[model samples]
Target: MLEEDLLYILALQRVKGIGDINAKKLISHCGSAKNVLKEKRHVLQKINGIGAFTLQHLFDKGNLKEAEIELTYIQKNDIETFYFEDKNYPDKLKHCIDAPILIFKEGNFNLAKQPIISIVGTRKITSYGRDFCEKLISELKPYNPIIVSGFAYGVDICAHKAALKNELQTIAVLAHGFEEMYPKSHKKYVAEINKNGGFITDFWHNDALQRENFLKRNRIVAGISEATIIIESAEKGGSLVTADIANSYSRDVFAVPGRSTDNFSKGCNDLIKRNKAAILTSAKDLVEMLNWDLETKKERAIQKQLFVDLDETEQQVYDFLLKDGKELLDIISLSCKLPVYKTITILFNLEMKGVVKPLPGKMFEAI
Candidate 1:
């Protein structure tokens, strides 16, 4: 979490030719960015991939100073940084071979809290694909899915809109910095997304938007999500690259099948044909997949067995909370089927076993 460590790593990643693998080797052997910056060519020579040209750039005076300047920038911006070793880092992404050592993010995204599923596909998405995205996410609203996707045009944008519509927290894995978004048209959604979710990138504030970054971007989009859903994709594009990377990370991938003759869905159909992706028919499939991993969900099912069916009073209280996540007193006689006096009695018992959280207003939500 220290600014120095984050700055050094971020600066090193910005090197012209260095990639994740090269940067990893440098960090692993040298121990710190400060050490790597100070090392001579001979010291770096011991590493397999460190060439003379690479070493020249590594030890260059300009790069070293730029690293310090970037660190200062981090302090000034209050930019939050996450390292691979950090507890709050995404567990799913940490396992990937090319995972970045540092991720620069803005807003309040809690990567540790839930299962993430990325939905991605063609930039020129069909009406059917957009409809599927909306319906699937709506069905998943009850599970509180934290949807992840590139906030690009077409399918990426559709998934994000659906996530927001369903009132779920979603993360947009950006290809550039929080200071800028590649597609200028998405600037407005980026603002809305900031309030509801977050944007993540490894590149720094001044990082330029280039076509090459999109390739690098795909890895992160796929890495952070538990499962990647390809809604509509052409034979070769960023979405397909992301799906391939998701497979490399040993993550499950699902594809929404589209018309066979449609060029836009060619990549997804090919993946399903090769068994590279599971054919996803609905959001229930994703909900069930994610539900299996929820620790509280299994316990809830068992606890539900205990009650089997709620009594008249219990049913009233339970029914009210099911409609919305609320606090105390609001659950009084209105929302529930029971009256205030009886509801309070049942609320106490439900609160005792950790089934619900009692807020100041006395509203309740499933725990």
Candidate 2:
């Protein structure tokens, strides 16, 4: 984004009572963040949900000064900024209504065309949880997914280390700003993580760490990926909160099942019981559910029928799957530029014609 727009966006972000949803509303109505600041108070007040309180600090001159300072810091540190509308913004996150308008990134990784999943659990992890977390990442190595976590203790750090060991990109979503690192002992892993994947946060460089920040950061962990995996958790913990957020965003959630008597397993079992998450027994379950194993499936030697018929839309969807192998329904919809409902209907039609077959996890493969 241009510096001018970024300056105004930072100022808007600093305003009190104006969260992402409202900021986006204001920006949409005014056509730009800069325009929103310059818009007449009466004009803004007329917009739905734009009350007097949200606008109280909207016009604060100090907001601009703070934004300038933060922008300078960002530039000095070589931090990258992704506006919500930017093409480079995380694709899944962009669809989330509550996603941050802008995210600051410091990493060597690129998210383009890669599958991403967040693995989160209790800070007090058990031996079983540790083993499961490590094994899951190692097993997923062939798919080369981008692993995401909060960069906290236990499962978070374990996931990061596993991804690094497997030579895969792993993103650490921070609850604090780039200026501070929590659990100071984990600072030792920072250099390696930076070299491999890197850190992401919506917080400013100098923002102080706060208890609530962890919960707030969970949304990013949940929203930025295709799915979330909880290796272990107590009946109540931040990882469960992340699961809830993932569900709210309509993302897939999986929980590693454990002995019912185990304290940490209670959360996973409860989630499975409540139908909030699917049972994750091993890497194979996740691989099938996400269609990540499709690439490894041997090609079927089926001869094409000379008389098989298909419409333009159906042909488009079929052609994509033929080239890409089995793919998620949403991916097909996106690639075909068709609505999901339309894609499903077309896929069904293709199925009827014996040209496609449905698979687990809402995926379809051309026959």
Query: How would you encode candidate 2's per-residue C-alpha lDDT over 1-367 as one tens digit per residue?
Result: 7889899999998998899999988987898999999999999999999889878989999999999999999889999998987799997887677889989999899999889999999899999999999988998898899999999999999999999999999999998889998889999999999998999999999888998988779999999998999999999999999999988776789999999999999999999999999999989999897766554433332234345778889878887777555667876886577999999999999999998999878878887
Instruction: Report the C-alpha lDDT of model 1 over 188-269, residue by residue, as the tens digit.
Output: 7876787788888888777778788887788988888778999998888888888888876656789998888999889999
User: Candidate 2 at residue 240, lDDT?
Assistant: 96
Candidate 1 has an lDDT of 0.76
**Number of the predicted model whose lDDT against the real structure is largest:** 2
Question: CA lDDT, every prediction?
Answer: 0.76, 0.89
